[model samples]
Target: MAKTLLRSVGLFGAGMIAATLAPAIGAVDVGTYKELDQFMSVFERVRADYVDKVDDRTLIKGAIDGMLASLDPHSAYLDARDRQNMRTQTQGSYGGLGLSVTMEDGAVKIMTSQEDTPAAKAGLKTGDYITHLDGKLLYGGSLDEAVDQMRGKPGTRISLTVVRPGRDKPFDVSLTREVIQLKPVKWEVKNEVGIININTFVNSNTGDSVRAAIAGVQKSLGHDPLGYVIDLRSNPGGLLDQAIDVADIFLDRGEIVSQRGREKGDIERRYATATPTDLAHGLPIIVLVDAGSASAAEIVAGALQDQKRALVMGERSFGKGSVQTVLELSDDTALKLTTARYYTPSGRSVQEGGIKPDIIVPQLSDADYKARPRLREADLRRHLINEAKVDDKILEDDGKPDPRFQLTADGLKKQGIDDFQLDYAIKTIARMSQPPLRTALAGAKRGAK
Candidate 1:
């Protein structure tokens, strides 16, 4: 029945009523009008006989919230305040301490402070849990409410009390809100290898930043980098168009990604159309990912891997292949609904199952594990289920280990295999300057074409 309703809604263009339902019905078999009449009758009775007066607006808002909440977790009803915040987030400017936060075990925890922002300058750590704001209790409150309390006009002051893991008591930090413009790319040249840290995929100048990073490497090394290491650790992705643009920077020509909806003939494919500006064409490219790397991050990882353009290192990505379409409501609120599921060039789904790294390298330490910082996993409270019934040997190959690449981890030392992954990539790049690996990759490319 729900599937039928969804199909009907899909046909009518989500949340819009059917043309046949626009007219008042004398009788209906499904009791749709009768249920609404019953609800209205109860509402009228409550207005007439309730112990106190109730605002109609409050009731209507509650109904809307309840309705949206009944959908999937990603589908949400955003009020005007939330809509404004969404705009602020997408525009990459917000008046606040400039910290990403998540709710964990009923407490608001700092995810990561934006670089050069008030939170970073004031010494807020990633693992700190916010216990109070402006001396008001914050735990057990909605994340939205906590965000509202933290945000204000530029130059306004706000105080936060945080519980650091190793600290004894909660510490108070006061900061003045300022407009935060996030820079997505940070880079450095190390041992003739270009290492670029992509914090997010949202900045308007990400492509320019990447190009500049490559140029910086070229200037430092007196030539283009022998190899490139892209660090995407702890990067929750943003902006699909930016992801497409970033992928285009590396590929000469190929399909980057594609989206397929339930409707027939709704498939859309995005392809690379430009040549790379960097001179590191055949250089050994290694991408670093972790559990925090998600969405657009997965798209880039999957696309590059499908084309065999780069070797992926670290853990599997956070699977979030669904695409959301934001719809404006009549009351100035909004709805961010998951309307489509995207697929990689190889036709892989990243919804519940994320992209498997070409080389698996555990990046977390015992200290990181014990810290118990709030992450998307904790926020979503995800539980892994057995999917063997679907494909018993999805990662297996011919009863033998697949040799597409080697997977290694540094273990819990935090300085071992995981740290060594990037070093190894750099070494591989250095060897690529004179190696059989470079010859093999070149041969593979020739074979592919």
Candidate 2:
């Protein structure tokens, strides 16, 4: 069986950085030889006439990099350093600012910052552009270069010139690098409700961590709590098998997710176990997702939502639905190639459109929520297109304001509610526990706004 996993830079990776081990291909046709001949022609010219002295290894590596870059943004050629970075991240420990970043038009754009890390502590939000590193311009630099610069000996300080969307001008944020030891799952009981925070799916044991969290919640409360709130905000995905495992924990039956390759007959579907594996025991559950929840996170959310096991709340997801298979070209090199497009159990492809939440719960805690623009799979250059047409009207509808969400950050703070989305989700579950209080509380909460 192939070992399928996803990774980006740090905890919450940027774009879709996942891979599966594949055997080397040996077939080559005459038409390919002609293309190789053309490539060799350019290679010879660069080697002979270039002003700077170039080595064969460097030229070949550059050619490979250019070849992969021509494809979708998710595909890339991973060198030794990149492979080591991927391994360290999936293992749940690394030294860096703990930010998941990607290249956009030669500038490095932040995907999301991992919780409790140096980047998150420094208040770097998604969609912020890193224009300079240590007062040196980083524009037109490769993502690999940026990542290599950011990740280094722990405790070393670095300054970043950030260009935020709503800010009047660029600002410098100084941060010290630290080892990011990821705790994939964290559970706590709030108002007799279980809140499970899944930070990332990069860990192979993430599914097991979630299972432990469920058991811990029950043990901590002396019984099964009212329900669970699976918080997947800013969680850029990880292992494919762990996604199936996590989704399987909630679903007793039915398909969880499916991946389809280029060939018409090449399709694989993952289903939940028939056993009574629903740990919550049919309790009311809610899945919270934001624009940063992607790939494996979307898989779990899509499975639970389609199976009617949980009510998905919050804003739309990051919408990265493709799978990358890492083919080892050499001992120290691999090709991360996008080979398939995954779909939800209900046959919905969340490529550019993402997983639309059943309830659109905006984050009222952030004062700059409305000013900051969101970055998703659709926004990337050379992204894979979803064959099924997406309704633009439906996509545009998510931006509209709701009367129930009229509260400002100050208003929420005064009410002692720092996170309005989480507070609302917990209150919603509390209402479900008491059916009689639903109408009265709903009216009061909505009318008060």
Listed in order, each prediction's TM-score against the native is: 0.75, 0.90
lDDT string, candidate 1, 359-402, tens digits: 76543332334344434331354422223222423632224444
Query: Can you write out model 2's per-residue Cα lDDT over 1-449, one digit (the tens) per residue?
Result: 23465412222111111111112344555565566667767877897999998987788778777888788888888888888888887775777999999888899999999998999999899999999999999988888899989988899999999999998999999999999898899999999999999998888888889989999999998998988899999999988888999999988788999999999999999999988578778778899999999999999999988877778999999889999887886777788889899999889999998999989998998999999888988888788898997764687486556799999999999999988999999988987767565445445434533
lDDT of 1: 0.69
What TM-score does candidate 2 get on C-alpha atoms?
A: 0.90
Local error of candidate 2 at 289, Å?
0.8
Q: Which one is best on TM-score? A: 2
Return the lDDT, model 2, position 288. 98
RMSD (CA, Å), each prediction: 7.1, 7.2
Q: Residue 331 of candidate 1: its Cα lDDT?
A: 54
Please, what is the whole-model Cα lDDT of each candidate in the order they appear?
0.69, 0.86
Instruction: Give the residue spans of candidate 2 off by over 4 A.
Output: 6-31, 435-449
